[model samples]
Target: MNNFIKNLLLSNFNKLLQSTKIACPKENLHNSNRLKFYNPGKVTYDGKLNCGITSYLTSFMLSYHNIDHKVWLSKYGFGDYLEDHVHITTNSGLLIDTTYRQFFIDYRSDGNCDYYKYLFETCEPIFVGSPNEFDLLKKSIERQNIKVFGSLNQDIKELSDFWKQDINITPKMNLYDMRKSNEIHPTLLVEIPSLIQPLIT
Candidate 1:
């Protein structure tokens, strides 16, 4: 991709990350702990956040911006068990994961999670192209004698349907109607326009 588009995507992504509140529920502490394999940092646990939320928020932002992207879920095998992580792939085949930083933060501070550390430090936005290409990259990593986590499995679920459903339920028309009827608080209504403008327009 050209630098201009790359910068635009990066800027919008950072803004979305700052604006959106992506968090898991502290009430589901047990479930949250189970997903910690994908979240390797103190901020994630303390903030009650997980990789799923990050993927959702990223998808939402991309949708709002009218960016052509698909959410990819990959299941990884851990001996007899499996775990999943979701991330986005652009129409042009670029991979983007705003949450990979969590792993880096943990690895930098604790000097553990070497695989995740290497991944975040090396890959730009993570893997590019299809899952097969991703598999090749993983194999390359393993060939280096690196103990890569999660052998990729066949179960992959695309999240475009979920995004469509969410958009349908939370239509911008309702927000506009609420604002027009004075049903929404003035301050919130004011804030809503800036955020929803892209989706509506």
Candidate 2:
């Protein structure tokens, strides 16, 4: 079955490459041509999990959508933007962050939620990953129209729930992340990026 899928992907890769659109920082794009792949590091709004699945997924989705963005990793190495929430452009682009709690619950104070509120009201943010986070995001938004994307597969029960709802979930597969490590080639484990080709095309 895997071989069949691989063959199908290989056969249609050209079409996917052509149809797909990716936007990246101009500097990154120029560098991308020279490097074998992109290796975006993990980051968050606070000095918490310097790395996370959400951080990596953000870069992956950007690559998937063909969009380039620079995450403001403050010089102090903490994305305190959640606390110091500021106005930002939304229509042209957005910022993304992922967390386990539903609706910024771990935030030490109302400031964090306020920041998210600002983000929702101003530059619409597109958040994805973790079902708990999604539930919180909706409730906090107040405005029923705010939209965020999320998913998780931590246990069989969750998977069963997802299946029961007939939600659009992708089958998991290993691909590659261009991030370099000491022993491994920069490429790390990744979901099947090529899978989107069929959905998009």
Candidate 3:
């Protein structure tokens, strides 16, 4: 993409991100202690659940903006499992989904999650492409008729119809390491715009 377009996308993304509402429950002592992983015989002290709120929000924003993103979903690392970050190439300005992180609350039905709301609030401008997961979340959030701010993808109606009968959805993932690889070579700044055509108007 050209410099002008890239700058415009960045500007819009920042504006949207600032307006999104991504809130999390405070980490309390009890919840903190429950974060340890356990095995049948030897329960190792694994650690806290990573916070993917930021990473997921970034990806969601990129997707909403119609920008091309490459996400990296990695295995659990130090600290919380959800604590992931977004990476944008300095030159090409492409987005990547380095990881897929989601959270579930037992008290709520499928998709009605704080995690999704947090992401929606954080990743501004880009409307959520009603992935089945997102529809389920929307249903869950409607108890109070809360207004959703951004746009919904054109496919939302179909996804809602297809997923309406399927209430039992589970969140699972294969964690990959998201750390930047050794600097084998310098980051490239290609002018190729095909990969990101979806994001640009």
Q: Which candidate number maximizes TM-score?
A: 1
Clash pairs detected, candidate 1:
none
What is the lDDT of every predicted structure here? 0.41, 0.29, 0.30
Model 3 TM-score on a 0 to 1 scale: 0.25
- Per-model TM-score versus the true fold: 0.42, 0.26, 0.25
Error of 1 at 137 (Å): 8.9
Score candidate 2 by lDDT.
Answer: 0.29
- Give the 10-residue window scoring lowest on summed lDDT in candidate 3: 168-177
Arrange candidates by lDDT, highest first: which order?
A: 1, 3, 2
Candidate 2 accuracy as TM-score: 0.26
Off by over 4 Å in 2: 1-53, 75-91, 100-103, 106-201
Which residue segments of model 3 deviate by more than 4 Å? 2-9, 12-21, 25-51, 75-201
Question: Model 2, 73-181: lDDT tens per residue?
Answer: 2222236532211111112344233322222222222322333334323422234323354445545543322232132212211211210222211212111133222
